[model samples]
Target chain A: MLKIDELEKCYRNKEKRSIFHTTKSKEEKKALDGINIDLKEGQALACIGENGAGKSTLIKCALGILSPTSGSVRLFGEDPRRNKKYCMQKVGVVFGQKTNLWIDIPVIESYKAVKQIYKVDNDTFKRNYEMVMELLELKDIIDVPARRLSLGQRMRADIGLVLLHGPELLFMDEPTLGLDINVKYTIRKFLRQLNQQEKTSIFLTSHDLDDIDEICDDAIVISKGKQIYSGKLDELKNVYADKHIIKISGMKTGNILSLFPGVELTEKENQSIISWDKSCYSVQDVISGVFRMYAVDDIEVREPDIDEVVSRIFTEGVSI
Target chain B: MKNFWTYLKISIKSKLYYRTSFILNMISPIIVLCGQVLLWKGIFKLNNASDFADMSRNAMFSYILIAFVLNNSLNWSTENSLSKDIRNGTVVSKMIRPTTFLSQNIADMFGGVLIQGLFYTLLVIVIFFIAAKDLFVPSFSNLLLFVLSAILGMILRLMINDFFSLLCFFVTGYLGIAWLKNAITNFFSGAMIPITLFPVTLKSIAGYLPFKYMIQVPISFFLGEYTFADGIKTYTVQILWILFFIILHCLIYRKIRINLVIAGG
Candidate 1:
């Protein structure tokens, strides 16, 4: 549903101002460097990037908020910049830090205003409004003014207002930033349900890895404005899932450590924890070899999570 | 158009949200009205001149009241809010919305004027009528002319203010630009003193600027200074200046979008 081709955005340096003289000096800094992406309909993708990796810039360009210095973004089949109104009609955006709702007004009033702005049909508005309020749990706080809402409540209202129009696609930029763990889980759960039940496509950018792990199946990892990885989250897991630890419960006299002297092993609480690079040893090897040598009471294999996978990708500066 | 009306309703609602602030808002204008009236009354008294700049003592009193209301009605500051939105990056929300930026902001101004300006204007009119009953009744013909001129003047002022607000896209701090705009409007638009009372060169300079149409020409019509032909000429010139500012706004908006620098991510 969305295609970004060779997208590059450069910001011009501000002019130097002085009383005596003004100079025509221009310096350009590229925010996005040749970003290429393709998102199919109903596919939720997480855009993983560092703080200055031009994630927001890429989203703004796709949304037609800021014109790209070069390249083009197409929503459905039309360029958003050329067909802005039509493009915006099919998309919902939630800016986590900045509010989309009107301040000094009740949260529900802002939702109603969004209804007018988007020209949402009554039926669609009602269905989405009820679903969003219930999922986001915006029941008691709907009457309160937006300025008085807590960070989580306001973010909920922001997301709900955009969803009120029943957009086909949602672009959320750091939707869980500054939210408490409980609030964060609530938002993630709301998004997961919205994607699963509604078949709504989501393009999410976040620093929180768990959000990506829960809501998105595909991920595009960028660092320093370059797209390094674009593939299935499971594929990244496979590539970065080199660290595997197996814990075996045994008495102190098992002498398992002496057998696997070449491998790294540690013990605690009557358990022999054997750690090794998955490239060096397999789970079958551990079961066949470690079990026979030691008094293996229990075996537990630990696979690395998405967060660890992403941390390794960034640390190693690996590109796909 | 539907969006415009909706925003107008919300704008008016926002204006009325702070009750204590509105009370204080009303008091400041009344104080300014009192001070300007007394100062003009003292000046006319000391000079022993029945008329200044072809305006009689009664005309000046009525003019001050009318000018005060007109100025208050146009007090919506597009710069302050627009700059805040830009700095905070919430303006990104506006960029993503279906409506253009100009339409949204104009709707916001209409909201501020219709709701906030309505009650204050009504109160000031009642007080003026009680204090100067004899001068409150302008001929219906004059009232019609004043109303038409005022509407055009408002559009012209909105164009001007929108122009300044767009400058916030380029400049870091809008305080200097905002103060400069207020200063120019107060002096050149004759909100502080009648344009006719100015020396010849300054009057000629004001004649060429759009700020004059925003206040001076409209007030001149209210004080019976403009005949039908004069009214026609004044509106023609004001319309031309309005067109000029519209073009200027378009040009500046294009440049701003090209260099669109939203402060926060």
Candidate 2:
């Protein structure tokens, strides 16, 4: 539903000038560099990278909030820049920190405003308002002013505002960030359900691995404004699947060190965490041998988190 | 039209959401009006002409009261708000909306004017009527001219304000410029006093300038000072300004948005 071709964006440093303002600085920051991406209809894509990854910049380009320095973005065969109104109707975007609803307005009133902005009819307004409020579990607080609600409550309302028009493409930037576990889970669940039931295409950028695991079918990793990886989330996981974390308590550091070869040791007094590359040795063999060598009080082994894998790809340059 | 009403209702609800702040906003205007009334009354007494060389003390008092209400109601603050919106990222949401950003802004402005202007101006007019009974009531024809000129004046004022606001997308910190524009406009526009009281040069200069049409011309038309021909000529000037600024607003909007997008590049 979204296609970007050879997109490049460079931001000029207007604030930086030569002495006496007679000269302009040629210095510029590349926010997006020759990136090509396509998001299929009804597919949920997750964008993961460290800070300054240009994830937000890329999304803004797609949304026509920022024009690419070169190339172009097309949403369903129309230029988003020229056809903002039509494109906006087809897409819903929620910036992580900004709530679209006015803080002093009640949730319902804000929804009404959105409804009018999108020209939703009375019947649709009622239906969408009811459905969104129920799905977001915001029935009780829908009449309350947005400023009076907690962050989580406001976020749900923000999502509700986005969905009022039943947009086919949803660009969610860390929608679950800073939410409590229950709210996070609820949002993740809602996202999954929305995508599956409505065939909504979602472009999500989040730091939450759990959100990615719960909702994304495809994942794209970018580093320094360049795409590093793009494919199935599991495939990307497999590519970075060499290491397994083994947390061991009641094992002496020296003894644990002796048990495994090529194991990266993380020690803390009586506790030690071992990162064993499965490529060098099977995690099973390493853990079993460690269990036999030390008097093990407790041990837990799990795959490396998606965040760690993605961060490694972003910061460690996909070499290690 | 539905969007307009929806925006109006939402704005009102938003304003009322902070009940304390809403109360304060309403009270601040009233307090400022009271101060203006007191100062104007003081000036009248010190002028030592209860009859004021043809303009009665009662007429001047009512004129001051209405002038205060009109100045408060007619002036627009959207320039500062628009500047802040640009500085912050709130304009992004408005950009995403199906409506044109300019239309959305105009609706918001009208909403504020409708609610705050109507409420506050009504209060001021009621108080003026009760406090000063025999100031001046225009003939029906003059009343008609007054209302027409006032409407035209309001449109001109908003156009000017919105035009300045569109400049925010160009300059850094245009709020200061917007404020200075407002102060200068209000001072020369005779929103505080009729232009007739000014020096001959200023009065003549004010006669030709569009600023006078914003307050003095309209109120003077109400006072039956302007002949029909004179009223039409003044209104034609206000309309010309309205058209000029409307075009200016559109041109600036396109230029600014393009520049902003390019700069973002």
Candidate 3:
């Protein structure tokens, strides 16, 4: 479990003042401000944000890698800043862009080093190593040096190395970045199982919305160093996303435009797509009206996906 | 301690993985040692001097060989590596580990130099046996003393290097800092030239500084230049300097960690 309250981090920025740059000034740039999060054991939370939006800074603060400018972060009910080594014993972190495995050594060697470093007992090491190897599909790549591995292979190796100690909490910053869809899916599935079956808490940040959609139940949206929304991913889509799209394919699609007033409709050769605002018309009423109007070959209703919902929240500055 | 050994093992394994590069690195130092020896021999022949600074030609040659080996044992740019890690953001991996930063870096430094250390050490023994058998051999007790001093010297060197490497966190570039450290260490530690050959003023200055303890003091013990009492005194000073650097390292690291910034996400 982890808790962050009013956690703020400010970095000093140096600015050159004169044309010759003889004078300089120091300014404070807030990387994170008034951010709060409480991740319980076995809960997987997605931290959604734009670039430079302080997601990584928040993780560093929580991990005691960076001291917060104000407020506090507690890991397992202890101030991480004061007790970082103790807190880190039960914590695992993976930066997708950077590797934790030693680049020149085989993946298995690095895992063994991690085992010794974390003082994991032989039994625990064996159990976790087997589970991680099986779940991450790392058996083939285990003997390869990290530098020779492809990006996906290296990432899988990194994840396996981090899990070899059976950390109670995992902080992953873009764990699936720059990977093919297959590898990403594999990693997400592995993480989901880790959370659900093993009861390990996950705090993840990524630009991939699908990663969030598939792996997390709760979500926190941040933009420009501030938390904009924090709640269930389902509620985020339902509340912020007002438009429901319906596609109807039939021979008589020409007159569908005038049938529904206030609803946006796009007519094609054989298909008519209706964009219905939930505020203006109920989905049930719209579907019934469409069915009563004409014979349809096929009709499908689609709610906004998480990608659209999150993009809307960011662009429209929606907050709750 | 277990973490330290593990990191050391990993570091050595990583280095050995690049088989060609590791072999080249090991051989390159021999070329430099040979060059230095030839250059010194020319100087001695040109001057037509049987001895320089009260050391015979064979003694000085032995000094150069031993010094070269010892210097290579401590040859690693901790600052360069640390700064690169800081710049590339790989330092975050180190920060999140369950071990302290000091232990990891120390293990890594020693591990990186271990192979070279063993290689140079064997080279020195072979060269001494094949080419310089007439060179003075220390008593077994003196050899034991030399080993102790050399171990302490290695510790002292690592401590000094670690202290300087921590400064990389405060600077954007480590080249200037590393150059300064190397210049000072090379000049004062007698790695480039034995302290016995230094002028009175330079020798006194070296005595006041801790760098001499890292190289010259241990080599002095090896060559029986120091009495038993002198060896004891040298150790006392080495331990004190090590203690100083340890305290300074801890204090500076604490300050640096407050402002630690990993360059990339």
Q: How well does candidate 2 score on lDDT at residue A70? A: 91
Candidate 2, A1-320: lDDT as tens digits: 89988888786656545467676665788777878879999999998877778887888789876667898899878988789889998899987667788777778778877877888878877887787878899988898988899999989999999999889999998898799999998899999999998899999999888899889989888778877777889888878876778888885634555666668888797677888776777777887777776677988886567877776776667753
Give the Å error, residue B119, model 1. Answer: 2.3
Check candidate 3 and list the clashing pairs.
Answer: none
TM-score of candidate 2 versus the correct structure, residues matched by position: 0.83
Residue A21, model 3, lDDT = 56
Strongest candidate by lDDT: 3
Best by DockQ: 3
**lDDT tens string, model 3, A151-194?**
99999999998998899999999999999999999999999999
List runs of model 3 lying over 4 Å from the truth.
A14-23, A248-256, A267-272, A294-300, B76-79, B199-201
Candidate 2 ranges beyond 4 A from true positions: A15-26, A121-127, A241-275, A278-304, A318-320, B41-47, B50-59, B74-80, B127-134, B166-178, B196-210, B230-233, B255-265
Query: Per-residue alpha-carbon lDDT of model 1 for B90-170, expressed as tens digits?
Result: 778777888877778778776766754577668767866687653545677887898889888988887788788777777
Q: State TM-scores per candidate.
A: 0.93, 0.83, 0.93
What candidate 2 keeps of the native contacts, as a fraction, is 0.53
> Could you give the candidate ranking by DockQ, starting with the highest?
3, 1, 2
At residue B190, what lDDT does model 3 achieve?
97
Clashing pairs in 2: A10-B265
Backbone-clash count (model 3): 0
